[model samples]
Target: MIDKDRDTKKLQWNIGTGVHYTLNANWALQADWKYNYHRNTGARDRLWGTRLIYRFGEGNKYI
Candidate 1:
């Protein structure tokens, strides 16, 4: 279940950048950084995160 009113009237901002490189013929590595901002109920929050990804196949994926 979901609440529409609770989901609405909220403001958020997000920015992200990522890079990928092949470490070997069968593997690749990726890194990413993200920043997020949320405002609600007269309060504001800023969050950031970093992620590292490894792939077994030819293509790399990140989140």
Candidate 2:
């Protein structure tokens, strides 16, 4: 059965976090994670990823 009520409401939310680390004056590392919550559909999704960054010009940086 499907609910056709026009007033029906569904709840959804997303939460995420990310971290950035400086490996050197011109290099960096990044990582991220995220999660999704759906109340009405009872479905969830998760994501994670990592990235490497590089700088073209010199600056007061490095890790």
Candidate 3:
């Protein structure tokens, strides 16, 4: 069955790590790296990706 206008999620391989550094009160910096892989049965079917992220937030929740 298929649903219209509904969000569907697919399975994919992903690995990532992140670190947060606080420069002072009420501010922070975050860095992250990720790898994603997609595979299929065909010989030419392959996908790979990397990602980075920086975020700022308040309080100790950023850690």
Candidate 4:
């Protein structure tokens, strides 16, 4: 059984990036994601997700 009455310090940090496909100058589709790594334990965490981006005016576009 899992401990329901426990206090665990899940201290970690995240640092990552992903490539994206530019559908247009205003819209884009990307595989944007990130990860969390435990600082003290050196254990990797599966803390990542997807994102949708919309831009106004051209600046730094990626594909």
**What TM-score fits each model?**
0.51, 0.69, 0.46, 0.44
TM-score, model 4 to reference: 0.44
lDDT-best of 2 and 4: 2
Worst 10 residues of 1 by lDDT: 42-51
- lDDT ranking, high to low: 2, 4, 1, 3
lDDT of each: 0.61, 0.86, 0.53, 0.69
The true-versus-predicted C-alpha distance at residue 55 of model 3, in Å, is 10
lDDT of 2: 0.86
Given candidate 2, what's the lDDT at residue 43? 95
Give the runs in model 2 whose Cα sits over 4 Å from its true position: 1-9, 59-63
The digit string of per-residue lDDT tens for model 3 on 11-54 reads 45767777766755555567666666653322232344334333
Whichever of 3 and 4 has more lDDT, that candidate is 4
Greater-TM-score candidate between 2 and 4: 2
Arrange candidates, best TM-score first: 2, 1, 3, 4
Model 1: colliding residue pairs: none
**Cα-based RMSD of the predictions, in order?**
6.8, 4.3, 8.0, 7.8
The residue-by-residue lDDT of candidate 4 on 11-61, one tens digit each, is: 689878887776777776677567878866898866455657788778346
Q: Give the clash count for model 1.
A: 0
Top lDDT prediction, candidate number: 2
